[model samples]
Target: MTTTRPVLYLFGSAAPPVFDVAAVVADAQGRGFEVCLGLTSTAARWLEPRKAGLERLTGHPVRSAYKMPGEPDVWPKADVIAVAPATFNTVNAWALGITREFVVGVVAEGIGKGIPMVAMPCVNAAYAQHRQFERSIADLRGMGVRVLYGDGGFVPNLPGRGKPEEYPWHLLLGAVEEIRGAQGEGRSS
Candidate 1:
């Protein structure tokens, strides 16, 4: 009904899987859905998306909220909002309705507008197990935010290596499927 494709809000630490991002985008676009992208501050550093490149890919302005003035938020017209490689900080902020930047603002807006939001928390076991972090995740779930977690999404036994290919394809695809199912696209051809 008034859904404008799907907007994916990507965030991470110093490094994230650009390949995963590309793969997800490719899959979604191939499925005949438009995609919009929002990058977190640190993510911008590793995967530098040219202004025009991002604009052309997402058909929406791509930016890191900190670098831009005012808050960048997802339009209410969006059908789905997904945070892939969701940082612990970002996840907690979203659950608390805190808006320190564009991505956070978009998450808060999604909550306020009752928009369906999905997140793939990409953090290590230690950080993820932290009491505050766990609580924040619980809070988000209570509010109807779908969270995709576990080792399938978290790579183990890898130290000091940051590669997009290291990220689990199955888990990422599963998250994508979750969003599709939520958007009523699961039954679509």
Candidate 2:
């Protein structure tokens, strides 16, 4: 469906940085995106107290569960998706096509729809050391999702030493803009 502004599906997992989602949503909206917020069930519970405020901020419902079958979609069709503060479990579940969670399910289906997508993992150094973590990152990248981890993206912190205030939320927003710009170029060419 056509929208006045690009629709961005912003999904979050149960990471410490997920608590900072209010600012992230505002940042996305400021970047010319109609933001729709989705979260892992755990993250939803973590932010329960702020759910109403988030709905007001995004002008849409905060979703953490699949809509009932045949229910009308409440949000605009996504032009792009950004999954930030992706936890180790979320990254693996998505890469393995395990869509038990609402956020993972949308992003998994988004891949087949050819929607531009980006992900930034919030794993610690210990989780990053796991073999599955590296494989999952590669798998998501192979499926055309731009993963913001290592180098210029999110760097894993030592366990128990994470600075949630320092999560690279801006980088995720920047990638969304870059993806939108690239899509615009492709359409014009």
Top-TM-score structure, candidate number: 2
Which 10 successive residues of model 1 have the least lDDT summed? 6-15
lDDT of each: 0.65, 0.96
TM-score of each: 0.75, 0.98
The C-alpha local distance difference test score for the whole of candidate 2 amounts to 0.96
Off by over 4 Å in 1: 1-15, 49-51, 66-76, 151-164, 185-189
lDDT measured at residue 81 in model 1 versus the true structure, 0 to 100: 71
Question: Candidate 1's residue-wise lDDT over 1-189, tens digit each?
Answer: 245555444433333554357566666677655676777777765667454665677666666664445754443255667777777778788888778757778777778787677777766656656788888878888988777765445542243444556666456556666776766864474
User: Candidate 2 residues 1-189, lDDT tens each?
Assistant: 457999999999999999999999998899899999999999999999999999999999999999999999999999999999899999999999999999999999999999999999999999999999999999999999999999989999999999999999989999999999999999999
